[model samples]
Each structure stands twice: as C-alpha cells, then as structure tokens.
Target: MCGKRWILDNKTLLREYIKKYRYFSLNNVVQSIGIKRCVAIKYLQLFKSEKIVFSAGRGFYTSEGREFIYPKISRVIKIRQLIIKEFPNLDFIIWNTLYFQPYYHHQQTHNITVVEVEYDGIQSVVEIISRFYRNVITESKRKLCTSEFDITNDPIIVRPFIRRSPRDGNEPRLEKMLVDIYIINYKYKIMADVDFWELWRSLFSLYRIDFSKLIDYAVGRRNMRVLISQLIDNAGLKEVIFDSKYDLLSNMTRKKGGRCRDGKTRHKTVGIIEKRNTI
Candidate 1:
C-alpha cells in the first residue's frame, strides 16, 4: 500500500449524511474533510475528472466554486442500490444475479466513480463497474474511451473494469454473461463521468484509499477515458443486433403474449377477397 490511507466504506446513514448537505465549500471543503489540505485538494481533483463540478473562481471557494453539483438524472448505482436495499437480500440478489458476473469474482474490482459536488453542500458519489470484457493494454488512449458524444461530460459514467489483482492465468477475466448483457443492454458510454474530486474530498474526509496513482492517472480526463475504453469494447456491441430477418422474427414472436410483430407484409394472406367472402 502507498503511504496514503483510505477510509473503509462507511455503512451508516448513507442517506441521512447525503441529505444534510449537497456540496462542501472551500472554507469547509478542506476543514470538513480531515485529510491534510494538500490531500483533500487531491481528492477534490479526482472528483473533477468525472466532471461533477468545476471551480467558480480563483482560489478555493465552495463545492460550487470548487464545483460539486450532483446529477439530477437518476443513475443505475443509486437506482439499483436503493431498490435492492429495500429487500436486503434482494440487493445482493440483483447485484450478483444481474450486475456482478462470475469472472468478477477472480479479478480485483475498480470503480468508475462520479461525484457531483457544490461548495459547502452535501456531495454525492456514484460508482460504476464495466459489464463487459475490458482487455488490458500496455499503453492507454484516454480521449477515445472517456469522451463519447457528450457522455463523458454527462453527470454519471465509466466502464470500470473488475479490480485487478495478481493473477496466475494470463487470460483477461471478463464476464461472459456481462459481455452478452453489455452488448445488448446497459452498455452506453460506460455511464461516463461523475464528480471525482468531490468524492475524494467527501469520502477521503471520512475514510481513505490509496488513490495516489488513481489521482495521477485520472488527471488527464481524455487519457482516463481512452485507457478505460481499451478495457472494454464498444464496437463489439454491434453483435447484439440480429443479422437475419428470421432471427428478428423469432425474437419478436417467440415470447408468450409478447408484442406480436411482423416485418413482412402477407400480400397473398391478406387478400381483400378473403374478407369480402367472409362478409
């Protein structure tokens, strides 16, 4: 572990704490978080990578000046966690059943975090994981992966690969089921960019993580995005679309009471004479 320390995930009052305030201001952003001023600033910098907020003026001001606005749109992490937490077991059920894949069990987990922060307000953090195969490459190309038709600029996103750990096998551990799911659904722009600095500020204050490398690498937003893209492929997603009309028809009709649709017009079967004869 690096000389830096990270806080353990705090299980208490996730909502109550978030609701009290929306963003932490400069006067408070540093003071509020226990980390040294420099470290706190570093965390805040990370949140900026997700584009959750921006500086309002010179010097530190608030989460707003420092910029820590939360996303207004509902995101998968909040939505899924909220729904699952209601049932307790249902939460794990949904995550493991739908989100978590078998291959994820082996690799380390990395979070694509987004934070929307405001100065002196409660800050929100969103974490996402890639649901597809993210191959590891020697060099990283950030912009291609991070920026996607305004997606990286969006309030929430990224295809965070499974956390990497020492692996005996050379194989890239990606979930087959996830590859299938991402190809068909839940695979758009990797939910790109959340407020990273706010998260560092907020989370770092309460807890700690070895974020030095992450902080440095994530600085170049485009580089981060491109690097992330290599881990997952958006091009392969086309496979989700059917190649044959027969397959499309089968998909449309195979379900019970599924919306019945026909691509081809039955020229002969719909002869007007048939209806006239019946009348």
Candidate 2:
C-alpha cells in the first residue's frame, strides 16, 4: 500500500511539472523532479496514455496534445513533387504565406507560393518551374518582381535564403517557418507590429515552440529574440516566459532586473489575440 501511494504521489508531481513547463525534454523532467532518467521515461509514457503529454519530436514532449498542423495551400504538394522529380539531387524547401495565417488575427491573402532553393539554382529552378506553370517569378535582393496571377489563381515565387541547412523533407519545419516569416517581414515590411504580436500569442497558445531550434535559426539575429520576448510580455503570456527551457532567453531580452531604461518593468504595448482565418 505504501509503494502504491508513493507511485501516485510521483505521478501527481510529474503532471504538475508538465503543466508548468508546457513543453520539456527528458533531461528537464529528470532534473526537476529528482528522478532517474529511466523512471522519467516511464512516467512520460504513462502520461502519453492519459493524453496529458505527447511527444513533439525525438526527445521533446509537450502538453499540447494535438498533432502539429500547418496551413494547406492548394497544389503545394504537386509543386514540391515537380521540383523533386526535375532536380532529384538539389535540396529545396517549399512553403507559402498561408502557413503563417494561424498566428496573425488579420486575414491577409497571399496569391503566391514560395519555393526556396540554393542561391545559385534560383534562376535555373525558376526556369524549370516556369516551363511547367504560368506566372513564375524569382525574388532577388536587387529587385522585386510582381506575380501576374490575379486573385483567382496562385502564383509561384522561387527564392533563396542567405544561409541554407540540410532539411530532412520537402516541407520546412515549424521552427524554420517561424524564423523565415520574420526574415521575410524584415525584407518586405508587409506585416505590422499588431500582426506580429497576434502571431506570437497564437503560436505560444496553440503549439509547443522549440526554443533551441528557434534560437539556432536566430543565432545572428539576436534582436529577433528580444522582439519575440517583448511580444510575449505584451501579449500577457507570463506562463511562456516562465517556462524552464525558455526562461533564460526570455529573461535575457528583458531590461536588467526586469526594469526598462525608463524604470518601467511591464510591457507597454497590447494587441488583439484572436484566431485568424487561413486560406
């Protein structure tokens, strides 16, 4: 009877810990609750059975309890397959603006889909895709080209990132998509501050964001981290800021000792948090 009581107590503790963190790794649980790594794994498995936690990736677990979902842009898979069939050896990632629709409250319709490839392969890939589809354009630093497609049809844009890494699949991961959206906004300035705040709030509320992956992508862009932290504060997502894995990153972006230069410790900006429609 005493052994059963101890087991129940540990299970309660584990659930509370998961509730606090929202997302965690195996090491996090072990250190937080002073349990053996193997024991923690068993507890996580039990939690999975109860739908209290689910695996986010190889070693990541989250209490979100839902499958990761991205926007469904029409013909995205067909476009990806065409690129793979034509250039089997080249690496590329295909995504569209719609992937970000869930985060922003305002519904912004994008008529173009993006296919990111190697910088040197941009023109060649664009040429190949153009042969197969109409209204294809290549985006470059020197000039921006408008797509010929109207509101009825979707246009395709072929571009490249400043730095590219090996991706396992044709679709970009969630972290990559989030970072890329910020980069795109920097270049295009299409999204307003209100849009960004809504996006951050929705993302934290709906999914378990992997801070390590996000930070890896934002290595040179430290300001992005600071901006994200500010958005979290403005959105009143204190729980996310207090998450164990993200606490350090969130704190670093704040003014020292939580006070700004003007001696204000709280965020000044506020934005609407609502579910935006995705096309």
Candidate 3:
C-alpha cells in the first residue's frame, strides 16, 4: 500500500510540476525530483500517451494545451549554435518572431528573421549565414524600407546596432523583445493600432514584465518614453505602472529632460504607488 501510494504521489507531483513550469527536459525531471532515470522516462511516456504532456523537440517536454507555438524560422536554433561555435569572439543576438509568440496569436506565413550584430560585422555575418544556407539572401537598407515582400528566396534581414546588453544565450529576453517590437512597429508601421494594444494587453497580463529593464533599454531611443507612457495609459495598466519598484514616470521625465507633470511628480508618484499597493 505504501509503495502504491508513493507511485500515485509521484505521478501527481510530475503533473503539477509540468503545469507550473510549462516546459522541462527529461534530465531536469530526473535530477530535480530524484526519480530514477528509467522510471522518469516511463512516467514521461505515460504522460505523453495520456495527452498530459507533449514532446517539444529532443528531450524537452511541455504540458499539453499550454505549449507555446514558436514561430517558424528554419534551422534557427542550429544556425545560432553554429555561429557561436564558429565565431567565439563575436557578440550577436539571433531570434525570429518566436520571441513574440506569447503576446499574440497568428500564423507565421511570412519568413522574416533578424540577425543583429555589432556595427562592423554586419556584412561578414550575412556572408557566413548565406554560406551555411545557400538560398538565404540579405536585404539591403534601401530594400528593407522600400520592398514589400520577397517570396522567392529566404530573406534574412541583417541589422547592425550597438550591443547594449550581453547576449542572453541566443535569444533576447522578454524586455528586449518588447522594446524591439515597439521599434519595429514604429519603423515598419505593420501592426494596426488595435492589434498593437491587444498585443500589449496580452503581454502585460501573461508575463511578469520588468519595467525597469524595459525602461533601461528604451531610454535612449527617440520617442520611446512617449510610446511607453501611452501604452501604459491605453492598456489601463495604471496600477502596474504605480506598483513597479522603479518610479517609471520619473524615469521617463528624466530621460526626456522634461519637468514632471502635475500627477507625475515624485510625491504624487509615491502616493499613487502606495495607494495601488494598499488596494
């Protein structure tokens, strides 16, 4: 009876773990839970068969119905890994639309991937990627602005920007993704106003956004302060703005070199913050 109870409890624990974490590797489960490797594999197989969990490439698994559908960018992971292996000295951030998957629901019919590297190495990196994938083509700055679409060849947009923060592996963090999306929307004018707001609402609701990190990234960018301020107001997430550990409004004002508005002064900001926390 004790052995049977242990088995049942382990199964329940595994289910709860997957539900909370959303994704896990087989080794992660075995090491963290102290389950024997073979036993863990068997349990995982059972879970998969029962539709409680699903495989997410190799040994990774995610809870059923909760798995995020990463955007389709062919060989993205492999390409990133290869780049790191070949160029140990280079600093770059490689990601596709997969980073924004959690914020919006859409089919990835267009193949647009961005490879951002240091300012000097843009052409070199593009050449390297093209060598690896023969069909891939680099878009020129003029072409990026003027050309609408290219369905014939695989297009990899190469951009050179000053690397602000260290690469967080091969992917940018959520804060970086948000800032990038904001910039892209401003430059491309692709996302509709309603769609943009809906995306922001979904992101704020689903993720623990680091407002400080976001502000840090957006500080130097032109019109970013206004964009963020408007987003906060339009989302009706005034409570989030006030509850954030950093004084968001003051930070924006300082960045913009503007005097604080009546409701945006330090004392008023503090009062609003306190009021929201109390509620």
Candidate 4:
C-alpha cells in the first residue's frame, strides 16, 4: 500500500488526492476504508459532477488501467524490472493529494508514495491485511473508485500551490482509515503522477532479474499492494499483481482453528475477528 494520508471529503482535500495519486481507483481508496458498495458509487458520481474525479470506466475509475486494479506487490516489482530497461538512476516516491494543491491535478503528483508506518508486530499487520480478505460485503471502494458517468456538469477543480518548508513539521497519520469509510456525496478521484510511467521504465533498467523468462509478475501479497507494485514494475518484469484476500482469510481461519481445535466460541480469537468482520 502506498502510504497515503486521508484528507476527508472536504472540498480541498478530495481534489488533492485526485491529483496526487492519479492512478488510485475510487474502489481501491474506499474499499481500503470498508465502505458499502451502493453508497460508494453514489458518492463517486457526486465527485464526478463536482469535477473532483474523472471517470475512466462506467461508474468506475479515477485512475485508469489494470495496474491500479490489483494490489499484488511481487508482480509490481517484476513490472518495475521491465520499466528499468533504459533509465537507471531513478528513485520513486509516493505523494498523496494533500501533498499537492488539494486538486487531483496531473502535474505536481507522484508515482509511488510511502509513509513510514508503525509495526506493532504480526497481529496488527494481520488485522490491517484482512480487509482484503473480506467476502461478499458490498465493496464500496471497488465500484466507487472509478468515474463512470459524465462529469461535464461538474465544476472545475482548483487550488493554489503551497510548498511545505522543512521547518513546517507535520505529524504523519498512521494510515488513518476508520473501520468504516465515510461516504462522500462527491466522487473522489484516483490519479497517478503523469511522470511515473516514464520513471517506471527508467527504474526497470536497474534490476537484477532476467527478463527472458518473464511473461508477467503478480504481487506476492496485498498489504504491500501499491508500494511493492511500483518497485516490481520498475524491475522490468512482466508484472500483474493480484490480491487473494479470501484465500488468506481462509488460511488464517483454518490455521488458528487447528491450533485451538475448538468447536466452541472463544472471545479471544476467531470469534472476535468474525464479529469485527460482520461490523
């Protein structure tokens, strides 16, 4: 996952994410926060109307292409290998909308952004990773992430650039995703910095992986979805990162159950997680 900070759906904040993470799909963004589907779609449309996000697919897509669709980090690394075929001295960063001017402008955005996160050990990682594991809950982010309908009636997005000086210390939020994503009446745009594609190809040239056997690559896991992906793609690997949310969830359930081997409910592990999932 690209370490993106969330600026709730205020007029200024929504537009910034659109510009900074151009490749972000409304689905990816909202789904990360666990919003309901119809509600997600409803808001995406509104964003389109307000010109906050541009739709690439029907009722879907602020960021276009399969690259943004899946969050497989390994495959992403492989693709990075392919991209580095030419440019060598390349480094990438993840810049979210708030870093820019609060409008999802194509200009002042970044390709891959990372926020230094706290590692509270395995349990926390598992819980955060499990969002990808959800089954059958109407995935609001999946549908809403894109801009499907016409946004011609939407207002033009605007902003004034304010560069943050080194002295302006801002504390980073720890992936401030609420258990439930707040629905926006306006569509939120997912965008990638336009320059990232070029940077990707350049980065691909530096990888040690041999491209001869490379057909494509898949992200090895989901939680590292965005960050790992850019690195992988830059490696010149034929990459296609994917998520196995349900797959992981199933394994987690089986492994934990086998250890306890319990038929009865215990508030400690499985029961608690299942209850959390239900909410």
Q: Give each prediction's root-mean-square deviation over alpha carbons.
A: 26.7, 9.0, 12.9, 24.1
lDDT of model 4, residue 14? 40
TM match of model 4 to true structure: 0.21
Q: What is the C-alpha local distance difference test score of each model?
A: 0.28, 0.64, 0.60, 0.30
Q: Give the per-residue lDDT of model 3 (tens digit) for 8-55.
A: 888887877777665456766777788788878888999889888775
Error of 4 at 27 (Å): 3.3
Query: What would you estimate as the lDDT of candidate 1?
Result: 0.28
Candidate 2 per-residue lDDT, tens place, 1-279, comes to 998898778788888899887766676677778877887888999889988887654466779865347667766877878878888888788887777765568877654577888888888888888887887877775666533434335567687754533234777766666666666565555568678667766776777665545544554333354545554566544554444425544322222234567886643211011111110
Better of 1 and 4 by lDDT: 4
The number of residue pairs in model 3 that clash at the backbone is 0
Sort the candidates on lDDT, descending order: 2, 3, 4, 1
- Candidates 2 and 4 compared by lDDT, better number: 2
Best candidate according to lDDT: 2
Q: What TM-score number comes out for model 3? A: 0.56
> Which lDDT tens digits does candidate 1 get at residues 1-279?
333224222212222222333322333444444446665555456555545434422222222322111223234355445434443332111121122321232321332222111211111112222222122111122322323323223222322222231111312112222222232123332322222222223432332122222212222221223322322233221122222323222322222232225744343312321232210
| Residue-by-residue lDDT tens digits, candidate 4, 1-279 | 232322244334445545555333445545554655664666567776766655432223342222111133442244234324322332221112233222222443322222111222223322432333321111121243224322222211111111221111222111111000111111332333333343334323322221111111111111222333333454232321124333222222322333335665333433434443311
Ranked candidates, highest TM-score first: 2, 3, 4, 1
Instruction: Tell me the number of clashing residue pairs for each predicted model.
Output: 59, 0, 0, 71
Alpha-carbon runs more than 4 Å astray in model 3: 1-74, 105-108, 132-144, 148-154, 242-247, 251-279
List candidate 2 stretches off by more than 4 Å.
1-4, 19-21, 24-42, 45-51, 55-61, 132-156, 161-168, 220-224, 234-237, 243-247, 250-279
